[model samples]
Structures are given as structure tokens and as C-alpha cells.
Target chain A: MKDSKKQYIRGEINKTGQSSSVGLIIRQKEPNNLETPFDQVDSFLTPMELFYIRSHFPTPKLELASYQLHVDGAVRNPLSLSYNELRDMPSETRVATLECAGNSRVFLIPQAEGAQWELGAVGNAEWTGVPLGALLERAGIEEHACEVVFEGADRGTPKELPIPPGPISYARSLPRDKAMQQEVLIAYQMNGHDLPQDHGYPVRAIVPGHYGMASVKWLTRIYTVREPFRGYWQTSDYGYWDYLDGKPVRRALAEMKLKSEIARPRVYETLAPNQAHTVFGAAWAGETEVTEVAVSIDGGQTWAQAEFLDPIQRHAWRRWKFDWLTPKKPGQYILLARAKDANGNVQPDQHDQNYGSYVINHPLPIEVFVDDLGRPGR
Target chain B: MKDSKKQYIRGEINKTGQSSSVGLIIRQKEPNNLETPFDQVDSFLTPMELFYIRSHFPTPKLELASYQLHVDGAVRNPLSLSYNELRDMPSETRVATLECAGNSRVFLIPQAEGAQWELGAVGNAEWTGVPLGALLERAGIEEHACEVVFEGADRGTPKELPIPPGPISYARSLPRDKAMQQEVLIAYQMNGHDLPQDHGYPVRAIVPGHYGMASVKWLTRIYTVREPFRGYWQTSDYGYWDYLDGKPVRRALAEMKLKSEIARPRVYETLAPNQAHTVFGAAWAGETEVTEVAVSIDGGQTWAQAEFLDPIQRHAWRRWKFDWLTPKKPGQYILLARAKDANGNVQPDQHDQNYGSYVINHPLPIEVFVDDLGRPGR
Candidate 1:
């Protein structure tokens, strides 16, 4: 939570980049801009408070006593549940990493632009909750129905969506199939403690896969429609780029891209001659397993195999490591890492910058310092 | 977002005594409590804001000015980025729905267990951002690296994880291969506006189909490690019971199940004489696509074909409808809808609840209204 607690996991930059009120290079005062020092070299995981915060608005505080979740409409029984009541119901849990679509936007060349997050906009966590499908069955549904609509507590008109014939707000729909999947959870706890106020306290829905928007926060209502939800969020925003048309196209929901990242050795570290350094990073898939990972030094000239620490959690990130023999003569060394999932998705050297930000797969790089003795330096 | 805008969809109770939130429900704050109203008439997509909301905690209002996303540890460049800079980089967008592992958890019984969300938990929206892989590439990874860690603004030390030795934060990791796919996104906008303050505004990551926790909101930092994340969220909280060992094996990430729901006739509605009624709903899958949808008015005794409406998106939801001839009797009529996707995954009649509150799929039902003359009541 403080710069002092921020461990220097990765090495230090010889010179600072730009300055902002929100980051290490830039001194920021908001939680969104809070940065942890990288000196602490713990094993693989990053602590929670030290984790980066990516928020759209300010953290909201709600009186637990006044909060309630309501279920009604096409259901035979209408009910209102308190946080305690929700917790009392059957509990379930899941481990996942939520990454912003623009976390790595800084690398895009020609600056086809949008959010400039270099790579500090993502985190992984465990969510605990009750399955949403269970509550619907309790409500007792009627026949002759079609679509399920999700609503959130956030209020604002998105600029990207077309104004609907009716008053527009944020909303999206799921087909009956997805609506019934139990993975959909009304989560109440993060890790093991109560949900954080900043994360959506009292309760939030954990929708696996898809983009973050579909996982509406501060959830308030549920709508069942025979027609598709045509809210501004659906028709106008987050659609897709028509690569062929060189314009936007109507596409399916976005899923996690095959991805990999280095987890240690903050850049610009000096290595002494004949020293051995260990490299670390993570990889993941939307719903599939991470089958393999490869690492390359010398600007990706050649590659070697990396080891995945845990292969049991298929959808979860797999830790990998490769031992780098210190360079005999150190000048400037560029370290590169890339990975592939079981699905045959290969990372791209670089992504095409489009107006509507989407689909990026570029190799990650790191710089290592090897002293004349060829050993890692202090 | 007002209570008047929310809606809930539903269908008839099934053999498992389960129902689904298939239609639109409205949210209205009344003197009594949060008023959630369901529409029993025409099946149509629910409007945004009017859509349902499901969350695990109070919505966080992130201030972009103070938000800082940090990329450190195990890279050539350990940098921090601000919201404004993120907007200047290349951007991407996609239409996707994030469904909770427990979205339809109501289907679970022994008496409805866990987070009691009745269908408003999931939402569809257009997500925009840069791929996390792109940023990692710019950071320059080193060899002997294993994993990348993601952290959020929310803080809590819950169940202890097995990865790191100390009390770690909520975090998860990805192996190298899966981390570099095109699907992974560092999102800055949702439904086309700066992300709503409640959602991970300034930034968040979208990981397609795995689970919501994987898509960390209010993202703040990225860490590289040799082992996968072992925070409470990953090891103890989100892990599932697989029934693999003599006891249930803990499954790490929640996977979606094949499911369906009906979103038409309001329960307890009266049917008029000689009036035609329409049956509607939508469908989805983890890796497969919903290819077929079927409807039944006689409670599984008989079934008829339904029509599918595709608006161009693939994974979002495919609207489906069926027209039924007016019934000749005045007795209660039951309606049901089911789907089959491109991968041939069919909606199941009943899905058993898993231990970790993961993806569940169950058949959907609808109760039609009938009058003395055998017609549907409006």
C-alpha cells in the first residue's frame, strides 16, 4: 500500500520515463495510481495491496445494512436477499486473472491510440460466491421466454454506443445457454475475506471468460426478454473491427487472448560475469489449458524450454522459469519470452493497431545486465 | 441507473424443480425496498441500466487522475502508466458477455445454495483495450522466468495460498504460452465510454471465457514470478471440487457449462382464447457455439422448431423465438426452450452443482397463460 512496502522485484530503470500522479515514474495520489516498489523478490505471486489498481470511478462505500439484492418478474416467487442470506446459501469458488484489454497498449507502434497502460493494468484473484443458476430456479420461471439481461449500479452514458430509441444505459444480454451456466456467480468474497469496497462489496457477479464489462458490478436487476438486448453497450460499443472493411464489424464477445509475461528481474539489472539468473513469468487461456512456454535471450534470436510450476489448474496461469547462463561478455542483452496454449494460438511479434482496440499478441522483452566477469551484479 | 430499468427473465419449473432468469426485469427504488419488476408479455431485449446487476462488493469509483498502472519485476523496463497515456496507445474492441460461474446457481438445490442471484448477474457489452501481451513484449522479459502476476485495487488477506511462503495478496498467474494469445486484453473502455466508475474504469483486463476473477478490475500492478500465484483467491477460494480424488478434487478455474433459459410469459398470467404465443431465449458455450434451439409447449411431451436471430456477434447471445398455435384447452400450458451450439453442445435438462460454485447449465422452462377458451392472456 506504500512505496516503502513496494519491493523492488524487477530491477530499477537507469532513468525514469514520464511522470504522472498515478505511477512509480509519476507520483499519483489515487488508489488507481498506487505503485509498489519492485525490490522484494518473493517467489512468484504479487501481494494484493501491492497489486495494481485499475478503477473507472472512486471506490464506493455502502452500508451493509441498507444493501439488498432483489429477484422478481417472470419468476413465480419474488425475493430480496441480504448479504448474509447470500453467504448462507451454497458457496463456490474460482481462481482467475482479470486483465485490462489495454494493459499493454504502450507498445503499439505508429501510436494507433487509446489507453497508454504499459503493462501494470492486470491482476489475478480468487472469488467465492453462490451460483446464479441456483437462485433463478428458486424464483421459479415461467414459460415462453428468451433472453437474459444484466444491469449494473454504475450510472453513465458510454460515448461509443449509439443512442437507443429508448433511454440508453449500460446493459448486455446472454443467450439462454450461458444464462444457465453455474459458473456465473454472485460473488461476495475475494480470496477468503469479505469483498473489498473497491471491488464491489456486498456482492458482484463473477462471469468467467468474456470481457470485464459483461461482469456487471454493483448489480441491481435481472431482465428476461424474448429478444436480444439492444442496449448501447451491445450495438455500438465493444463491437469489433472489420479488418476487411477497414472499419468496425459486429463480432462475438471478447475472450482472453493467449498471453505470457515476465514476472521477475525488473529491467536494467546489472549481472556479474559467470552468474546464473532465473527468469520467471506467467501464461494463460480463456477456458483452455496452457500447454507450453518458450523463452529467448539475445533479442529472441533463439529459444529454449521453460518449466511450468503448476499444470493442474488449466485455466489458471502457469508459472515458468528458464536459467540464463550469465553472458561471457556483457554489452546489452535483450531477453524475450513467448508462450502457446494447447489451442495452437501463437503470440505475434507485433499487433496491428486498429481504431477499435482488440486482439494483440506481441513478444515481451526484458533487459539483463551481465558484468565483464559475466556474473549478475548487485 | 434506476431500479425502474431492471428486468428478470424466467421459464417454468423443470423436473429438477429449477427455473431460469430468461427475460427482462426492471429496477425501481421504492419506499419498501429495491423494486424489481418482470415483464410477462412480449419477449424483447432488456435495455441497459434496466438490465440486471450482480456483484460481490460495493462498486468502486476510480478516479482516473490518481490511477497508476505499474509494470515491474522481471522485465527490461519496469514502468508505470497513467490513464491518459493508456488512451494514446493502440486500442481494440469486442462485443462479449461475462457470465458468472454462478449466474444461474439457483438451479442448485438441497434448497437453493450459495449466492442467490436470480438471473441479473450476467451482462453483454462492447469491450475496448490493448492486449496485455503487447505491453509485456515492450517490457522485455528475461530467460528462466515462469509467471506474471496481476493485482487489483481491492485488498484483503483471506485464505492462505500454497504458492508463496508469506501471506500474499489475491493474485493469479499465466504460463508463457497462454499469456501471449490475441484474446488477452488490457481494457480501458466498456460499452464505449471511459469505463464506468463502478466497473474497472480507467482500466481492467478481459480474459474471454475462463472466469471473472481472472479478469481483475481496478488493476494496478504486474509482477513476474517463477511460480504461479498461490494467493487465497487462487488456491483456497476459487478452487473447485472435482470429485477426482476419493474426495472432490479442487478444480482451480471455473469452466462454463452448457445451459438454456426461457424468457417469455410471466408466471401466473392468464391466457386468452385462440391467441398465439411466442417462445424466446438465447444460448452459449465455452469452446463451442450454439447451433440449434428447440422449444416445447407441452412440458417436454412435444417440441417445435424455433428461429434464431444473429446480429453479427459470435459469443454474445443468439436471440431465438418460437411461435406456438393457440391452445385448445384452458388448462395450464408449460413452455421450454433448449439450444445446441456449433460444437454440438446441447442444453442439458439438469446440471449437478459443483463444489466451487462453477459454470452450470440446465434446461429452461416457461409457464404460459390460458383462458377458459384455450387462449393466452396478455
Candidate 2:
């Protein structure tokens, strides 16, 4: 990013106070990373300003008049469509939750390097755009094409990356089958408004059910690669690294695992004894629907079913609530919540992931104090 | 704080997204604690929303129509003023910096108990209200008065407080001389706007050059006590516990120490070699003026004087900038900033203060990567 560009963005940020009303906390400034507070995620559609931002490079300056998305490689016809031209095509809108692959890296007991995110690096938004399948169908993919690669306009040589020194476009690839799924969208709108700059203005890829890395922002190109695209994002970063039987196992992060988070009764929150308190939280799953959520207020010794809120949308999170009556005794209590998805995946009791802290869906222990006379209300 | 009151406040916070634009990150939610990101303190007068909040209890809900501030004790004429009545009096505005005593507790090696604040737990703002000196003069303080105690409306039994379990109002006291300073204000306005709810809406005490704990929020009572006030905030919580001359010395926290913080070129920020980058930051002092600010690029071995910006306000922070020309050889560089005050006080290179992490003015080391063939426009 240029100093001049940074100054411009800073001026805009100062003038408009972007995301000031979204309750999202900034993690990094240059690449412009932000995360939402878990408790602030009370609605099914995450506010645009509260949406978590994960940028590999500074937001690119693009003019809608000149912005062109090129679709080429292993295709019968290479097409370069302008912003308006692309928007004029058949469009579909879907509610999907996008989560960073390293969402809960900070929660890892041993800690991990990267953005020290808690549980705020995920948000559900209504995305409107043309389907990637429609675009690929228009381009006529070749019979041997095995991967679809998306490249964002934002480009920079990541500082400390061991790769050879050269500017690289932020890119990620998806298998042919996933790329053809109708749920994958070339999004130009978020929620109900035009996509914000930090969220990929003009156009971006919205891969429902997959980690945000697969949903390339500030998108500029779509390539039909005959073989699996070996981009740095896919080969070096985002991929999970762990050991099984003393053998190294590497898996590229894709679908988000079943996860549940206690939004209410924040850590160290004092609760009034014998009072009924409503425990609110959110639960999500990748591809599959959340079937049930359980709450355990006594260090997970026993579990009770929680009521799921109405209008549970596909590819989006489901809100759950439980009426918890405080124990007659006043002391410290560890609260835990877990979700079970239709795919038979249950939130794990502990996180043992080693590589980059990816897919850590371990139920976090929320410590709350039960004080009979701590404070009025609850 | 009652649960209903908390829910009401949460509803308001959700409706307005109170801290959304301020870039202040939430540290704890129940007592409503927030800290500003170091880089977000760009201007001399921090936007009201960006000001760091340190509430020991939930913000008290008070209606301006019925709000009353009682001034009694060692005063010739006890005064009780309503919100409107208080505003009707002569008002003065002063730019002052308010810093939590534990602004950089997170950086304390070996760690410390309490909110792990980074550099963001401080902000400079313009406070508008009648000076405490003016108010005290109107009340005609008794000659025997030795201390002035300010008590806030917010009250609750602090969870895990070492003291006996009971509800306690948040209170602090000032020496007779400090209490009569013209800079001490019973502020009702912040940054040209009525104070926000979290910022002590109707009225709050503003003690310039003193730590934030002295500026009691949601102020409700003021007493001209004949002897020193022995409140938990003053004697037990905020006091420093450290060994001096082989004996324990417990000193009450008062004015802030000389401090400087780098606001730009965040940690691990990659810079392009051979590029001129301007490093921006702010420096502040307590009861003294910052004389100079120094920047070091090579691990503090060599130092260079940074240029101070214009319009340095009294009792507020001074913005400083350093033009750094990156070395041709690229690797990693540690940047450091320190401030010296007129009272012969210099920011220490290391933090050794143990209790409550008060007045920690140690120069923080910022690591930045310099890539030779990195992207242009640093």
C-alpha cells in the first residue's frame, strides 16, 4: 500500500468513522483486519459495519467504470465483463456465514501465531450476487478443468513470507465440484447495501459454508485451471498442519466445523443468586443445519437443551437461548454451550489442534460469579 | 447495576453502536470496560466515542430532570444543583488527557491482575464545565477542610474484591490544593457534545493531568471533608504496592507519569526499504509539559529527536512525528519512542513498577519488517 493511499484511507476513516457503529474492534490497520464482539452478534444478519474483515493486502482503489472481471484459462471463451455488465446478469441472494480459518486462534491453550482473534472473526450476512456456476457456464469450462481459481486485485509481497520475493495477488482455489455449486456467488452487495470498500467493493466471491479465505475479496479474475491451483494462499497459508501417528498431515481449510458460543453472561460476569437469567448465544455449522444446542452451567457436568430462535436460515447461524436459574449457593461457575449439527458433528469439549489453530470449535468455558447481593437486576 | 438497566443500556448500545467508530476495543462487558487502539488516538482531542472507559460498575441510569449533585461537608453553604441548574452556571472548557492508571498493564512482563490494557487506555478530550475552584468558591469551603471527595452514582459489590463483601460507591479524593485547581472540572460536556451515557452523561468529574480514576464518572456527590478520604479506590485498589529501601511503600496514585506511544507503523508492519516513512505518535505528561520526544530505530542504541506538531494544548497530549528513511539492507527493525517532561522526568526504557501497573511510561519496542524488493508506496 502506498503512503498516499494510506493517508487517503485514514482521512476517510477519520471523517466517516467507518465501522464506528458496528461494534467491531480493529485487530490490524494496514491490511485492515477487524472482528466483532461475540455478544454483539444478536441478529441473524450481521450489520455491515460489524462484519469481520480479513484482508491479505490493503483495500485496492478501483473505479467501477473501469473495473473489469476477467474469466479465462481452460475455457472456450475468455470474457472480461465490466461491473455494470456483470451486475446486469442473473443475480441471486443468499444468507451465509463467513468465518476466518483462524477465528479462535487466541483461544488455543498454547497460543498460536497470527491474528490473536477470540470468537468475533465470524459473521452472517445476506450476500447478493451472480452465481459462479452461472459465470462458469457462460465461459464454457473445458472437460479437463479440475479447479477454479479466484484472484483479488489487492496485491503485495507479504513481508516475512518465505516465498521468493515478488508481488502476489491474493488468490485461492476451489475444486471443480464446489466451484459449480449454486451457492457460490460473485457478490457485489452485502446485506442490503453496495459492498463497502473493506468488504470488497465492485465485486467479490462469496463461497457459502466455506472459510472466508475461499471467498476472495476485491476480486478481479477467475481462472479455470486444469490442475489444482498451487497458489501461496493454498500451499503455505490457510492449510492446517498437524501430526497423526508421528506423521505430518496437511489439510486445506474449507468448511467451518460445528461451533457454539455463549454471547450473554460474558466472562467474569456476576450473576444474581436464585434469579432467572436468560442465556443467549449463537450456533453454526458448515453445509449442515444445526439440529440442537446444549447448555452446561456446571463445568459441563450435565447438559440441558436450549431453545433455538425462529426463522433459522440455511447457511446462516441459529440463535439459541436458555433460561438459567442460578444455584442457591453463590460462587464461581463455569458455563459452556455446544451445538450438534445434522451431519452428526458435535462441538468438541477441548481443542487439540496444533497447526495455525484452524477449525478450533472447542466449547469455551465462560466463568461467571454468582453473588446474592453483588448487584440488583441479574 | 440491575439486569433490566443492563438490558436497557445494551439496547441503547445496540441501537447506536456506541463504540463502533471510536476504535476502542471492549476489554470487559459487564462493568463496561473499553480501551482505545493506540493508533486510533490520532487527534489531540479524541472523539468522545473513542475515549477509554473504566467503569467499576454498570453505568447508573439517571434522568437529567431529577439528577442532583450534592455539595456539603466542610462548606459554609451546602449546594445541591440539578443538571440544568449546573449547566446554567458559568462554564469553561479545557483540553485534558485522561489515562487509566493501568494503561499498559498488558505489556507488564510477568503479567498483572485486572484488565490487560494496551496503549489505548488513554485519550485527550475537551471537557466543558464549571471549574471545581469556582464551585468551591461559591460554596465557601471551610478553613479546616483538607480533602475533597468525589462520589459517583454507580455502585455495586465488586466481584472478588479482597475487602469484605458489600456494596460500595466508586469514590476518590483530592488534596485541598489539587481540588481547587482551575483545571479540575465538574464536566457535563465532552468534545462539544453532551457526554454520552457510558462517558458519564449528565455530569462527571474531570481532573486534568490526573489519572482517570480521579475523574469519577456518573458523579453524584462532592464533600469537603476535614480529613483525608479513606475509600477503597484510594487506599486499597489504586494504590501502588512496591518495595522501597527494603520496605513496602504503598503510595496513592495521583498524576500520570511522562509517557509516549507510537501510534503508526503497528507491530510487525512491513516497510519498503529506501522509502521515507513518517512515524506518528503522541506524548503526554502529568502536571508537567512534555519537553521533547525521541525516536530510536535501531533498538534504542541510536536516537533521533522527533518533530512536535502545532497547537500543543495544555493538559492535553502532544502529537509527534519522525521522518524515518529505511536502511537499504532489509531485515527487521525495532522502533522505540520516549518522552521527557519539564519536571526532569523521562520515560523509562523498562517497566519495573509492580502494583496495579500505574504510571508505566516504559518505551515499548515495536518490531517492523523491512523488505528490499517489497511493494512500493510504503
Which number leads on lDDT?
Answer: 2
For candidate 2, give the lDDT.
0.79
Q: What does candidate 2's lDDT look like per residue over B221-319, in tens digits?
A: 888877555455654467654432222323458888889999878889888888888788888898889989999999999999999973556689998
Candidate 1 lDDT, tens digit per residue, A1-378? 243234323223212332223233222344334333433313233445444444443444666887777765567787688877877999888866656555566566655344565555555567788887787777765564455666555544334322222233345566656667777777887666676665667677766655555665666556555534434454344444332111122333556677777756657777665666777767767666778889887888898988876564733567677777777686778877788877787677876433245455477677776666532353
Q: Which candidate wins on DockQ?
A: 1
Model 1 Cα displacement at B302 (Å)?
61
Docking class of 2: incorrect
DockQ of 2: 0.01
**Ten consecutive residues with minimal summed lDDT in candidate 1 chain B?**
B27-36
Please give the interface root mean square deviation for model 1, in Å: 20.9
Candidate 1 global TM-score: 0.44
Q: What does candidate 2's lDDT look like per residue over A1-378, in tens digits?
A: 233223223221121244334467788888899998876556666777678999888889889989999998889998999999999999999999998888878778777667888888998888999999999999999999988888889988764222323566788889999999989999999876789899999899999899889999999999887755545565346655333222222345778888888888888988889888888888889888899999999999999999987456768998888989998899999999999988787887777443345777889888999986746653
